[model samples]
Target: MLLLICFYQDQTSLLSYTAAPSPHPSWPPAPGIKLCVFITRLTSRSFLTLSGHGYGVHCCCFSSCGSYLLSCSTDGSTMVWSSDTGEAAAVLQHPSRSALRVCAAAPDSSLLLAGACDGTVALWDFPSKTLRRCHPVSEASVVACCFSPCGQMFVTGCTYGDLKLWDVDMSLLYAQKDAHDLGVTCCSFAPLFQVDGCCVQLRLASCGQDNQLKIWIVSQREGTACTMKLLHTLTSQSAPILSCAFSSEGDLVVGGSVDKSVAIYDANLGTLLHILKQHDRYVTAVALSPTMPWIATGSMDRTVNVWRIGDGDSRTGRKLPGHSGLLLAYWSEVDVQTWLCEEGLEELVSIFKANNIGGAELSQLNKEAARELGIGLAESLGLRGRLLRKIKGLMAEQSGSEAPDEFLCPITRELMKDPVIAADGYSYERESIESWIRGKNKTSPMTNLPLQTSLLTPNRSLKMTITRWKSSQ
Candidate 1:
């Protein structure tokens, strides 16, 4: 058995167990035990259920130091609590007694930003424990707020899909055009990183009901006005992406969706890295642990799941050996699949035996569901090829239906529509392989050897074969 252990802020232990000698079907086995990729092994995971909020929690943020946690809820109150002791540190009240829809703490933890239903953004002075300033951001309800790393300014997203920049003194700086077609649900500032002695790169990430994550790059000088530019536009297959966050280092991004999955990405490369399908309801909020290798996600189901960041290449679809029992349990029950869409894992698991679903008879259905769900999750996260092969193995019984290895792109596990041969004499999709060569990487993804040239030779033969195969299907 492989034993995976996790330690949280309060030294709570979460344990999971899996049998070893298993390898993800697509990946070759490395010596020793492997990490279980799915959110199974529920016995080993733990989370703190903060209860002071009388209603649903809209947001949860950890301080820069990760010593405290600030949670804002629809209960018209925002509370600061000790992450270690789970003790309430301070409670900030909204003047309108409206639900605090969003909240953020400055990097220094000296100030707090809370957005309420009354269309006002309140600034709270930390040490003084007093209302510092109350600024009306819009006539519509303010739904999202984030503090820049330096804490000089912050940004707010409203129900009207407007994004407004505000100064620490409650002055309006700049407002972007309607960032999303629909309501903006969440926004986060990338941790400010010093670019040089004189300037810093300030980036912001926001997501909304319109199914888009916009990365805004801010160009700022020491004393001059800052200019903002749209860096990248990430569109999701899931119609409404509810929450998004940047890693403490600002190099990674995570977003939660209404489809009950969390997507992780390489922020700089704009590559989808992993799709976490653990949640059973709309993920309402996501927060990264500044000090620990974990990502916390809160959902409409009223449960928080903290995922451990395993030291593995998330892009690779490495997983344990497949088992038919788990496969059937996942696929056979139409009710379980429905519950996976409508309820939490506990509810899904509880109804397993009661449904009278079991055995190898349901393997085909499970395989089909796995394929559809995996593809949908991957596409929703803008990770087209990232997860196609990892879950592909779940269709163990349908071995003959698997695509020929030569038809697959080496960089992305998905089948190639336009195959190409690089100077290294290896085949890959035209786009995937070219992206690797054109981007920061100059070496071949398959061989890791330096490419003599970035030129790619089209493989018309492989394209014909893929076309013929598709026609046969």
Candidate 2:
């Protein structure tokens, strides 16, 4: 059976589905498997079902920005759907017409890869929806694939117990034959890369039918030659692992197994951190939210469970107070009015309410926007001045101060709203670094040396810490 699960950045909605065989004759029938995807909004308690795959969907993944959802199926096609509208965006057919077992989208959403049962992998350009190339990477069925954080390379695993690394051009970089005693099931790369002088280090986790989970260190020196070495081998679970994923900051790794348990591990020490046993059947899929302390797992019993990772008690889940836990971008109109009242700007609440100003609009309000909105003229000059200062104070509260130095972005020197780790092993504000690179600067902001890659991985752990600090204040 096929199962998939995904979560929104705000924890507002969840995407999950189970598959059952359909009677349609458009394609050959696969016994006892399902053929549909479902998107569920937790707030509204609504469901949107996507039904295009002719057979069981083996895997599904959301794009980097969570705008699009991609799924691969035994029907020999990879389908893309708009996350907002639930409409099919494109249908990518496998060149060999073989059943696709897994699919992954690149970190930058520039390319997509789908692996087939015949060991053929089809690479498609994301923007144009056109096939770029198809290469046979293994002699056995290609069951697992994932792109590296740098977006310059990817790894693929097959039923032959082999793991191979390749560049974006599809050229093999390294191969580990017999990486697992049995077939490989899933693999994931850590979101951050460590830069040591001219060498870059990446951590990868892979699990297989041998009932073992292994971690490897893949090193690339001067962006040229590469080496792979096993660092840790974990056999905490009693059954074969079916899925695995790394947390956003690479601090933890999670795996789901046929034993109906989800295991979380400390990525650095490779020690078992938690074993969650809520599923009644084999756990088939697992995903860790990049922006929140939430874990989602899909099981063969046709259920998906979400678990929260806590600081004091990892086993206990707690809720944050007021607007402390919610992202400012997702604040509602009522939330904004409440904030205004708390800030002693209750006099202007009517005006803000009339303009339908929410958290997002509040964030963009400035002197010009305020004047355009008639706030500058309608209110007394002194009141306007207080309002402006309060807004600035809000920005400062969200950015830096009393916050840990590590939580501040290196470039902006402010508390980061969207933090990302660069190649130099430092986290920075996403907009600042993106603008820096967009201006044709290739040197590392912290090291003053040449950057190995332009890719940036989300610093989810740091962001969560900042959020907690804000809540405590």
Candidate 3:
């Protein structure tokens, strides 16, 4: 027989268990009263415990800047907490007077949304703490909600197994009926997107009571036409999946299941990477840190587990401290050699050095360039494939640094093709600033002061200047 004991303290919890002898007369009783005792001490990494909610908390999310935390509860209200301190900044009552089931903050931190049990969805201006819109989105209760990476649109999942996409004005743009078998439990949008001319492609993941996780490819064209298609369906978990999240880079997906297991998968390949079984009860919530290689999971057993992704080793097989923060566009021949060694292509280091392939030349290398370099240089197809993938990733990062700060939107941080001047006397991308204003923010995004007006004027001069800059490049 085994006996377990637990002790709770102000900051940590202590657990102890003991194993006693079997109670059988004929059982081999070797030695006198053999007993084994094990003592385990579990410490909490959490520094604060938010306790303002009167009922159970159904969902919680952090702001993009990590300054605020929003939690929805069954007490008919949503509470916003200061992430640095344990202070309840504000409490927002649900307009439906029903329990709030889920909440989501915009990627730009300009808007807040809360879904109620009565099928009501409320949008609030995050900066001004003012209600913007409250509408009934579905016949059944809304259980899941998330904002797109651009902050211009959001998706809501209901208990009726329906998924609806809405713009910032609460206008329904698209809807899919019976997305899941029973009901949609949770959904998340990837943090990155792909641009194909005038269309933007996004990846969305949703899990439900059907014991499955589905990934969908959502595309938005130049006009109002939008389309969605099923990309991948994952059935790694035996039980129903309760929660799902995407990594910062959108390369990995994690799901928590009612079977008390957490499964991590490759978002692109749709393959399972790892399964973690630590919680004794149903795992209800999962989140991946945007700045660190850590995952946090919450369970119905009232325990939260934090797991690190790697074993303290560098992700690229080896660490190169000298080239830690250096950009790929400025790497020298020696730096390229060091990177080759870090990526386990040390055998090709001599060849690359002989060719004098620096960062600038390496970033311009493609399949044709690789073939032109020589069949003997990159003879192995496997080696050439890995080198090209790494080079492509590096080139993408380099492109991000090529854009000038003046031509980039302050909110989205991307190069602006259509610049507009807001009432705050600052220029921003037309779409980005329009979304911020539509979110009901009366304050300026840069100065945080009340805006003179809500009107925006096209900045033709800035737009022409950006066009010239692009042409020169």
In lDDT terms, which candidate is top?
2
In candidate 3, where is summed lDDT lowest over 10 consecutive residues?
Answer: 13-22
- Candidates' C-alpha lDDT: 0.63, 0.75, 0.71
| Candidate 3 residue lDDT tens string, 1-473 | 11111111112211111111123222211211111111111123313445666544566666777677787865568878775554789999877556677899998899999987678899999988788989989888798999999999999998888888999999988898999988898999999999999999999999998889999999999985678899889887767788998998999999888776777889999976676655665666776656556566655454556565766343312121244234465577998999989888897788788899987788788877777766225457778888988888765543332345578776554578899999989999898778767754456655545778878999999999889888886
Error of 1 at 368 (Å): 20
Q: Runs in model 1 with CA error above 4 Å?
A: 1-51, 301-473
lDDT string for model 1 (312-355, tens) is 44333222122221323334455334433343334334334454
Please state the error at residue 166 of candidate 3 in Å: 0.6
TM-score, predicted candidate 1 vs. hidden true structure: 0.55
TM-score of candidate 3 versus the correct structure, residues matched by position: 0.57
**Model 3, which residues run further than 4 Å from truth?**
1-46, 313-473
Per-candidate TM-scores read 0.55, 0.60, 0.57
Model 2 agreement with the true structure over 20-102: per-residue lDDT tens digits: 22222221112122222466533234567777865456778878767788988756799999877779999999876677879
Clash totals in order: 3, 4, 0
- Candidate 2: which stretches are off by over 4 Å? 1-36, 43-45, 311-473
